[model samples]
Structure formats: structure tokens, C-alpha cells
Target chain A: MSQIDLQKILNQIEEIQALFVFVQRVIPYLEEIIRFVQETTPLMEEVSQSILESSKKMPTAVAELDKVSSTTESAASDMLDGIERMLDTINNSISLIDQINEFEKERLMKEKALVLKLAETLDGIEETQAANVKQALDDFYEEYLAKNCLQKLRQNIFCLQNDAYEIMNSLQIQDITTQQIMAANDLIESVQSKLVALTNRLSFLFSASFNVDSSQVKIPASMSFNTMHSIQDINNDAPGKTVETHDSEVSTNEHPNVDKIIKPAENSTCPVIVTKEKQRTNDVNIEQDHFLQE
Target chain B: MQKTILIVDDSATIRKLVRLVIESMGHHTIEASDGLEALSILTHTRLDMLITNLNMPNLDGFQLIQQVRKKYHKQNLPILILSSEEEPEIVERGFNAGANVYLYKPLIPWQLRQEMNKIFTQAKLGRD
Candidate 1:
């Protein structure tokens, strides 16, 4: 235990104190990181819970949409059937009325001829009375049957049948609505896949720290998109595309294959931002260009 | 004059509605559910008019019209578009594809008949 030994002991003591200070400085940062983890854990779990909840609900909603399409189509078919039956019945009625009018009209004309021939043998007031009776018979065919049955009633029925057809035209909305639903289904499916991918990435990143399981929630892959076009990405690709600028309204154009197209309208409600003006390039002729879409 | 017409659309309701109009006018109507179905019918049946919708499954209206235009019967058979596709470029493309007239959906029943009659009259006049 000389002075050199004392110096060695002091150096060792200083090194220990420096190491303690370094650890002391690092402790707050470590505590902050631990606190951040503690705060974010619930938030992450909440996000996972929210995603799980949405994934569960969307499929039920999609099933309801399918029911709506099927039910509407069935109803439309029934309605068309009723309309067709009505038209057939009306046409048959018109034919029957025409046949009856012709027969009754000919019979009335021959009876009037007989009455007039018999009146030639009648004297004074009876002849005029027979003439009046003949006039009444004439009125029955011309005024009563022709005016009421042939002219107005048939015409009205024809107009009514046209009105029924107009009702059928309104059924076009079923197809259009189906298209809109298909478009929505297409979007929802896309969102589902993206969310699933995001969750997978997130789970992989936090596997060591988080209790989140990658398999906890899953969104089913979409079975099919709309049948409006083929599988060409140029032809049938769904959005992330938006409308090119036009007047004040958002563009809802369904054709997505233009060369200069940046995006298509996401929906009626979502306002589109056009970074570049879209040009309807006439170059991508459907005959010449073809490609497969994912 | 009555003429035989082909109504091509994926929607059965649409085809039926158009058929009702044609039949009501004393004309005969044949239907095809898609473009390919239409092509199959066109191979054997002689049509005076072709009423079509633009978007469809297998071969679309544009493709259908193009194929029809290439045939000899296209000279007599006029093509009419009954579609909800209102985009200008798309409509222009339809006309360029050889559609004689383009009609939008939610169509007035009488108006559609009037348009069809007008087309028939024009085609008859053209032949004369």
C-alpha cells in the first residue's frame, strides 16, 4: 500500500463514478421510452379492436347488399311479368271489342234496313216513329259503342300500357344501382386487403413487443369486381384515381383507361383534386391495346 | 313498316322493356344478353336495327359494333345505343363505333319508341 497503489484505487473509483453518471443520464431517456410504450399499448390495442370490429361488420353489410340486388331483381322480374300479362290481356280485350263492334254494327245496319223497308208499308205517324227508332239504333253503334268503346276506351288502354312500359323503364335504376353497389363492393374489398396488409406489416414489426396476433382479424378477399369491362387494368381498374377537372361538379366517369388520366372520381361526396389536367387520349384503341389487371 | 330488331343488353329487364316496345309496334324482337350472344344471333338472323348497351360481360358494345360494322348486313342494320354512359368521349366513341343514335337511360317510354320509329323511317328512306 504505497502511493502508486492509492492512485490505482482512486482511478478505479473515478471510472466507477463516471460509469454511474453515464447510467444516471441514460435513466430518464429509458424511463421516457418505457412511458411511451405504456401509453401507446392501449392505443394500438384500440386500433386493433377497431379494425377487428370493422372487418366483422363489412361482410354482413356486403351480404345484405347481395340480398338487396337479388331481391330487387326478383321483384323487377315479377313486375315485368305482371306488366306483360296486363298488356296481353289488354290487347286481347281490344281484339274482342273490335270483333264485337263489327258484328253488332252489321246486325244493327241490317235491322235498320228491315225497319225502313217495313216503314214503307206503314202509314202517317208510325213511319216517323220507325225513323226515330232507326236513328236510335244508329246512335247505339256510332255514338255509344264506337265513341266510348272503340275510340276512348281502347285509346286509354293503349296509353295505360305505355305508362306501364314507362314503369319498366324506371326499373333501369336496378341495373344502375347494382353497378354502384358493385363499385362500392370493389372499394371495400380493396380497403380490406390494404388493411390486412398493413396489419400484417404492423404485427411483423411489433412481434417482440406487442401482444397483437396477425391472425386475430382477417378481411375476406373479394370474389369478383363489376362485369362492366374485362380484366385489363387499363379497362377495369378501380380507383386511387380521381376525376380530372371539369366544371364545378366532381367527375363520375366510369371509363378509366385514358393515357393522361390521373384519377377518377372516388365518389359523389368525395371532392377530387386534380394534380394534372386529364386528356382523353384517342390512342389506346380497344382493338389494339390489351393488358391484364391485378 | 314492321322490321325485325335485335336488342342486346346484359339486363333482362332492359331487353324485355325494349322488346315490349318493338313488339307493340308490330315488329319482331330478338334478344342477346351480351355481345357474344349478339354475334351468335347476327350470324344467322337478319336484323334491321341493333339496339345495344355499352358495358357488358365478354365482348362489350364497342367490340360488338366494330365486329358488326365489318359485316355486309351493317349496310341495312342501323345501330342504336341505349346506355346510361353519359361521358362525352364514351358517347363519341359509341358514335364512332357506328351507332346511328345514342339514348340515355331512364328513357321516356314514348320517346324511346319515337326514336326507334324515327330510325326505322330514316333507314327505310335511305333504302328507297
Candidate 2:
């Protein structure tokens, strides 16, 4: 062996020592992580089981809340509907009162016109004839005209007063509707706010209880002999053959093709490795046995 | 057919280690004490791979790789850089210089073998 080979052997031995130390350090850490997982799994499972039960409770609570919200919504909607109907009724009554007031004003105008015509008739008579005419007119008023005129005008005033009362009542209805609408708005807002709060609480609870299993922390081994052994197997079957075959025949090219297959042969201690005779005899034995069997 | 590999480093120990690894693999290794010596050998002889150390007295591994990459543009030579330095910047520099594998020492034989095997296989596939 060359001095270089001796030096490499020394280096390999050092590397192996370092690798052993590294592995020694790492194995405990891995065991600790594994042990921790093993110890913590039951605790985690218990926590998860409790969370699952709590999650079950959440759905029932959510369902109750949903029912309450739906009922409240329906009740509020019905109240609004009733209020809307009341408003429509008030609006219709107000319109009717306005029509009655318009009819009363027309009646009043007609009565005033009749009163003016009577005054004009009285002006057409002379003053000297007034004593005789006044007596006759007084008799006519007492007997026929006075009763009719006073009764008709009183009836018109009564109708007008009744229309004004109706208008006042309609105004009161409108005020009550406005108040009811305001109250309904407040109720709806409060209910919606409560529902939103419940939803937010549910979201928080859901997130908190969602169990996350800490997966096994995998750390690479310091030096895996198994991995090395597999690599050696591959090298033995393919690359090793290439190296042995190529190295036997030297190339004349500026860049020899053999450079690609070169590696430090690790199995040098096996004295039987380089010999062709041992392999040939083994092959011959197999062949001779096969022939004998045939 | 002895696969010829060039080892470039100022450290006698590292060169010796690499030479041993190469020989143990039943391949031939040529030594260069520095980047300049590596460059001279590279010019005269064809190599399968170059295993080098980054820090050297004259013409460090980086300069050597640069020179080789420029000269052997057609050779498709695989280079392995062995160094004790663990700085990210230094590793990037080695990669930038066209090193196929960067090994931090103390070198593991198995790891070294694996890397060498990969380079050889890849180089062979490229030829095929």
C-alpha cells in the first residue's frame, strides 16, 4: 500500500469515530422525541376525546340558537306585517277624512251663497214698507224659512266638526305606527347582534378545540451503514464491473473513458476478490451439476 | 483501465487521504500541491474527475476550477470539492466554480464513495 492509502485509512478511521460519536449523540435525542410522543399520545388522545364531546355539545347549542333566531325573526316579521297593515288602514282613513272635509267645505260655501241671496232680497224692499214687510217676513221666517235654514246650517257644521275629529284620529294612528316601527327596528338589531356574538363565540370554540397531532419529528441518522451497504451492492453489480473491465485495458485518448468508472475499492481486504480462477471454478461447478442433473 | 483523478490541495494530509480513497477504489490519482500545479497537470493529462480543496497557498481551488472550466469546455469533467470550511458563501463559490459535490471534512469513506459513484454513473450515462 502507498503512503496515500495509509493516510486514507487513517482518515477513514477518524471519520468512522466521529460518525459514531455523532450517532451516539443523535440516538438519545431521537429516543427522547419518541418517548415524548409515546408519553404525550395518551394525554393528547384524552384531550381530543374531550374536545370531540365538547364539539358535540356545540351543535346542540347551535341548533337551539338557530331555533331562537328563527322564532324571533318570524315574530318580528309578523309584527312588522301587522304594523304595515295598520299603517295602510290609517292612510286610508286619513284619505277618507280629507274627502269628507272637502265635501263639508263645499256645503259651507253653498250655505253662504244662500245667505247672501236672502240679504239681497231684503235690500230690494223700501224702508217705508219695512214695518209691514218686516212683520210679513218675520211671520214667513217663523212659520217656514227660519226653522229650515237654521236646521240645515247646524247639520252642515256638525258634519264638518265630525270630519275634523276623524282627521285628528287618523293623525294619532300614524304616530302610533311610527313608534311601533321604531320599536321593531330596535328588537331586530338587538337580536341580530346577539346572533353575531354567538357565531363569533362558536368560531372561537371550534378553532380552539381542533386537535392537531404533532407528527413524529424525523431526524436523519448520523451515518447509516445500511444505506452504505445498499450503495455497495449497486456498485458491486454495475459500477464495479465497469471499473474492473475498463481499468484492465488502458485507453490512448486524451481523456480516457475509464475516468468515469473509477472509485476506491473498499473490499480490498478480501484476498479472493481479484482472482478469476475462483469465479470460473464456481461457474464450472454449477454448469457441471446442471449437466449431471439433466 | 485505471480511472485517473486529479487531487488539488495545499494540505498534504488531504491530498494523501484523497489519493488513498482513489487507489482503494482501484483507480489512479495524480496530486497537485496547489491550484497552479493542478492546472499544469490538467493541461497535459486527461482526467475523469478533480477532487480539490478550496483554501490553498497559491491559486486556490476556486481559481483552479475556473481555469479548468475555461480550458476543458468540452471535457465535461466532474469536480468534487473537499474543504473543512462550512461557510455558505464558500460553498456557493465552489458550486459556482462547477464543483459537482462539496464535502466537508473529516471525510467519510462511504459518503465519499457514494458521491464518487454518482459522478461516475452520471458521467457514464452522459457518454452513453
Candidate 3:
């Protein structure tokens, strides 16, 4: 080959050498990138599997939440029902007190009339005895002494009338007891209403949290939205009304809707975590309802 | 006619008070500390009327009334529930369980007498 051709060959050899060096330098980086991809492939698969497992548990978690919410609402409703029953009992007791008070008042009035008549009769006796004693004073001193005894007897009769008055006044015990019981009943009813409101709010919160409907939750019939709304309306209309009046309104019956209140466990939309013992107890309650209906 | 009344209560004071009131009404009162004792007495004695308290040991008034209803007709043998429990449900239960009348505790003397008289009158009418 000529010298010029030798030079061109030398240049080509140098270019090839540079290219080879570049490839050699890039090869390690490519291998590192390949290694990194290989390592992350399993990690991506593991992440995808974890996401799939979580997605599978979503419905189960929601179900559990719904169950918990239902249980809590049911328990609260039951407690509210129990408190309402107690309030009804208190109101009945108050009614008894009123009846007793009426009876006692009538008896006292009758006794008072009788005692007044007795006083009138005693006055007549005293007047007659005095006139007779005055007429017989000169003829019979013993009769005068007997007149003194009669006067003392008249005073005793007056004292007896006063004792009767005192006895009549003592009937205030029933009044006071009645008032105390009414106050207690009012307090209990207030607590019940507050509990009802709280239960409603809690049910609403739970329903919202679980993305469910509040109306679907099984609450006491007396603590239903309509009942609460009515109570609120009453309160709003008559803010000055006593708690006793409010209590009277609510405690007039054991449950506003007796049939609705009977089967709360069965009416729940969510799963109830009832034990075997609780199930048996519920069965008994159902049997009692049947018996009552029968 | 002096009727025999069985007064069942847990409190001795209440029993005694009831007995006194019943006796004053010219009725004979048999006392029992609880429903069980009352039941035992009932098994042996002939009672004209039964007055029971709702809250009692051994057996509650509800249970007693239920048991008594199994044997006695409401009209034939009168059962009066005299209890501190004034729940409408309980009252309803008492009446359902063959009770003639339900009277609440701390009862007025005359009111109780009136109720007793009413039951006795009913029983007499039924017998006639």
C-alpha cells in the first residue's frame, strides 16, 4: 500500500479505538441499569399483590364497620327504651300520688265537715249545760262542778278539732313526695331525651361514616326522627313549659310504637354480634311478646 | 263476709302496713315475705284474694302472676298487683297474667280499700 493509504488506515484504527473505549465505558452503566430493573420487578409485583389484598379486605372492613355501628345504635336504643320505661313507671307513681292526694283531700274535707258539725253540737251542749247549770247553781253546787267538767269536755272537743286540722295538714307528705318523684321523673326524662338526641346524632355520624342511611338504623320507636322532631317542635313552641310536661308527653306510653320496639335485633340492617346467651334472651323476649299478644 | 287476702311483699314494714290496712277493712290478711313463700302459702291455703308486690326475691311478681294464671282464672280468684313498679308494660303484663287490678305502692289507704272492694265485688258477682 501507498503511504497515503497507510495514513488513512491509521486514522480509521484510531477512530475504532475511541469507539471501543466509549462502548466499554457505557457497558457497565447499562449492566447496572439492567440489574436495577431486575431487582425492582419483584418489588413492583409485591406492591401490586399488597394493593390487591387491601382491595379484597375493603368490603370486609366496611361490613365490620356497619356491624359495629348497628350494634352501637341498637345498644343505645335499648338503653333509651329502658330509661323510657323507667320514666313511665315514675309517671305512674306520680299518678298514684295524685290519686292518694285526692283521696286524702276528700277524706280531710269530710272530716273537717264532721268536726265542724261536732263543734256546733258541742257548742249547743255547752249552751244548754251553761243555762241549766246557771238555773241550778243555787239549788245544786255539785251540778256546777259537773258543768265545769262539761266545759272541759267542750275544750277537749275543740282541741280534737284542732288535732284533726293538724292531721289534715300532715297530708302534705304525699304532696311533697309526689313533687319529688315528679322532679325525679322530669330529670330522668330529660336524660332520656338527651340520650335520644345523642343516639340520633351518633347514629347519624355512624351512618355518614359508613356511607349508609340513618333511617335504616334500628332505633327505639320513641326515639325515631319523627319523635325527636316532635319533641323539638314542642320544646321550640313552648320553651317555658316545665320538664314535667315534656316528660308527661313522652312517658305516656311504654313505647310509642310497641310493635316496632319489639324486634330491634331482627330489624337491624347490619350483622349483629350476639352471643348464644344473648340470642336465648332475645328469644325469651320474643316469646314474652307473643304471650302478651296472645 | 270477711275475706282472706294474701299480701306478698319483701319489706316487712310494707307487709305490716298492708296487713293493718287490710285488717282495718275487716279482712283477714296472710303475709308472705316473697313470691316463693306466697306460692307455697297459695298451694296450701284457700285465699279469697291475692295482693302481690312486683319486685320480690326467689320469684318476681311477674313470674308469680304467670304461674298463678296457669292455675287460677282471673274472675274466679282475683289477683291484685300492689307494686312500687308502675311501668305501663309491667301493669299490662300484670293484667295479662290474670291480675284483676294493679295498684302502685305508697298506696293511699282508701284507694287500696276501694280497689280491694272492687275486686271483691267482682269476685262475688262472678261467684253469684
- In order, the Cα lDDT scores of the candidates are 0.67, 0.56, 0.55
Expressed as tens digits, the lDDT of each residue in A1-294 for candidate 3 is 999998997687557545544543444455455445446645754554555555455555555555554454444444434543544454455566566656755665565555555555666747564444344443444443355443454455456544533343233233334334445555655655555556556555444543433222222223221222223222232221211113225532322112222212222211111111323321111223232232
Model 2 chain A scores worst on lDDT over the 10 consecutive residues at A282-291
Model 1 misplaced regions, further than 4 Å = A1-34, A123-163, A208-294, B70-76
For residues B53-83, write the lDDT of model 3, one tens digit per residue: 8877799888888888785433467788887
Deviation in Å, model 3, residue A157 alpha carbon: 9.3
Q: Rank the candidates by TM-score, best first.
A: 1, 3, 2
Each candidate structure's count of clashing pairs: 5, 8, 0
Grade the docking of candidate 2: incorrect
Worst 10 residues of 2 chain B by lDDT: B11-20
RMSD of 3: 32.4
Q: Give DockQ per model, in order.
A: 0.39, 0.00, 0.01
Positional deviation of residue A215's Cα in model 1 after best superposition, in angstroms? 23
Q: State TM-scores per candidate.
A: 0.66, 0.30, 0.35
lDDT accuracy of residue A29 in candidate 3:
56
